[model samples]
Target: MSLLGATALVAVALDQWVKWLCTEHLTEGRPVKVLGGLIYLSLLRNSGAAFSFGSAHTWIFPVVTLIVIGWIAWMATRLRSIPWAVSLGLVLGGAFGNLGDRLFRSPGPFQGHVVDMISLFEPYGQHFAVFNIADSCLTVGVALAVLLELTGRQRDGSKAVKKAT
Candidate 1:
């Protein structure tokens, strides 16, 4: 539980810190090269999911995020493996980070836009979706969770026994 809480807190702190930096220094719609064009910092405000899908139904995101947060909390109560704890922590932190934006950012509560700044390969997300640290955490956490499941690693720190076919 300690590991999970600490990881979540750290992820949220780092995510929010970077978002604050981006909001303070980056200009909207302008791309700043970060790694010789491999990556660029371009500010964008997205009210919907990846690629700005379902932007018209922005309220749904916060509701879904809250449910996810609750589910993660429930899972944490039974978590025993360090890897699972970290994975869930990252997911929870990412959800909370984005939820904060939805609840407190501009354009009113539950309709606020997420601040995205990182663009890959091309400017203004021509090559990829513009995302933030929270998105990165969510993606990595989900990937790790999938890998763990595929390997038969259980949340109780035990390996699943292969059954005879």
Candidate 2:
């Protein structure tokens, strides 16, 4: 899982750097178009998961994030395939990206909010949920992992038995 470790570190660095830029340059709740009206950087402080779900349970996210981090670390020891490594790296990085906020950002530790700034879907009048690079990485990584699974590729570099048609 050396590849996974390296990829995860890189992902975390990139995610955190992007978030830092958003925190330093973008104003919260203020939308600034970057690539026309379709894409904008709209800063937000999320105390919950996607779409601001479970905002009331801010403390729980940090705990869950920690669990996820630990789980990824455990998985790293056995990771083999590139797809698996990349996928896990993205998940791990995204988890830590937000975890960093939960552990260090404003309000209080383990109750801090995630920093989101990227937004899309302006052609429809209403933008999609505010998100960040970490979220993007997580979505892509998960999709890739699912694709790998469906294609009979196992995380440990083995192929699954093909079922009779």
lDDT to native, each model = 0.92, 0.84
Model 2, stretches more than 4 Å misplaced? Answer: 123-125
lDDT of 2 by residue, 1-165 (tens): 877778778888998999888788877656788666778888788998888999999999989878888988888787778889999888888888888998899888988999888778552126478888888888887898899989999878999998799
Among these predictions, the greatest lDDT belongs to 1
- Highest TM-score among the candidates is held by which one? 1
TM-score of each: 0.98, 0.92
Which portions of model 1 show Cα errors greater than 4 Å?
A: none
User: Per-residue CA lDDT of candidate 1, range 62-132, in tens?
Assistant: 99999999999999999999999999999988998899999999898999999999989987888778999
| Candidate 1 lowest-lDDT run of ten | 26-35
